[model samples]
Target: MSSIEIHQFMCRKDNFGVLVHDREHGTTLSIDAPEEAPILSALQEKGWGLDYILTTHHHGDHVEANEALKARFGAEIIGPGREQDRIPGLDRPVVGDEHLILGEVLVETIDTPGHTIGEISYHMPLAQAVFTADALFSLGCGRLFEGTPQMLWDSLKRLRELPDETMLYCGHEYTATNARCALTIDPDNLLLRERATEVEHLRAAGKPTLPVRLGQEKKTNPFLRADDPDIAKAMGMEGADPVEVFAAMRKRRDSF
Candidate 1:
């Protein structure tokens, strides 16, 4: 199998655009088009040409540049099967649990429909990475905009099941705010407190806090802690259903 290289950069305010390159095949794909300028710039900077655009969901910010990039590079576009109509320039549509061969790399699509009913995350086991779009974020999860809290919670569970070492590349740079909100709910958690401090320091230094290890998120992300007895107890929802606890946390985060 060919080794894969990943590049992550800021695009359109807080959104993050990721590029995945299969070195052996000399093929490069963008995780989401995000915005044309930055995506184009990144490709130029790397001396790579875009061959494909993989869309995770139907949100405007995520797919807004799909057509432009495809036009500019003549790249084939692959996106969620359920929302193919919503994504621009979709050449191949995929649903959950599908395997796609991009160069020598195997891209496994996991259907995580919560942020949007057709949200998908791309997992590359060989690369030890997952591009979680808006379904999961660093220290946080996407808001319940189109799906129920239970659906979103279940989606997060799928991601949490990945190997602890899997590096998470999420959609946005919202870790600082997520850290603040998480601290309010898990103040007694030593790791959570420490992670919050570290996140602040990284942001202050103008560095990206993303591509975090799933192991670290499991230890500190509040959304992923709904099932923890301590967190449930701290929220006064002890012995309640984890989904209920998750719902409560989501509500609090909404207002937070």
Candidate 2:
């Protein structure tokens, strides 16, 4: 480990962004910006200069502030290759499986195209963190907006193969609401039940319930545990493949 620093900032109440600052490498990478005001205020209040803006997808809330921040800080804008037209001022359009270098940190971009046509998640080996934008949330996942449900399910499966310690960081503060939805499907799930309790406490105390570990997610998040028998059974399918089970769970969550 190179002592990477992760700062989670709650911008605009619901919208969230992350700043990964590596002091040893002297580089700071800013995740998607739902709005420019929060990004600018964060940079000023925390005395951080935005070096790069990594957008997960082309949604307005995700990339709406892309152009403004890039012009102000001259930061490199990295967007998924599938959305050149949707994302603004894309300095680098990366495809899936491309390795992105951020100073001493190497971030592997995982193309997660279910939420949007060009959605991608950033993975860092050293930090054991994944910025999963809208593709996957704490207890739920993003809706199938562009790609098929199968595409999103496959993307999440690939991410699940990572080390159990990998930390998940999403684009929004939807943990509390997501946990509530997960309970409907897997109420007896020990991990989910415990997490709901914990999340409630965090929310009441006005704290962030993100950067959850991969091991923890596997135990609770139905979207990530499609292979689990309980999840498949809840989906009303016997021996249903992970993709089918995941799709049903996503559909339920969408309506939840």
Which candidate number has the best lDDT?
1
lDDT of 1 at 102: 80
Q: Per-residue lDDT of 235-254 in model 1, one digit per residue for the tens?
A: 99989999999999888878
- The root-mean-square deviation over C-alpha atoms between each candidate and the true structure, in angstroms, is 1.1, 1.4
The residue-by-residue lDDT of candidate 2 on 18-97, one tens digit each, is: 88888776677888878888778777776778888888888888887888988888889998888988888888989889
Model 2: ten consecutive residues of lowest lDDT: 38-47
- Return model 2's CA RMSD, one decimal: 1.4
Q: Which ten contiguous residues of candidate 1 have the minimum total lDDT?
A: 1-10
Number of backbone-clashing residue pairs for each candidate, in the order shown: 0, 0
lDDT for every model?
0.91, 0.85
The alpha-carbon deviation from the true structure for residue 147 of candidate 1, after best TM-score superposition, in angstroms, is 0.6
Candidate 2 ranges with C-alpha deviation above 4 Å? none
TM, every model: 0.97, 0.95
The runs of at least 3 residues in candidate 1 whose Cα sits more than 4 Å from the true structure, single-residue gaps closed, are none
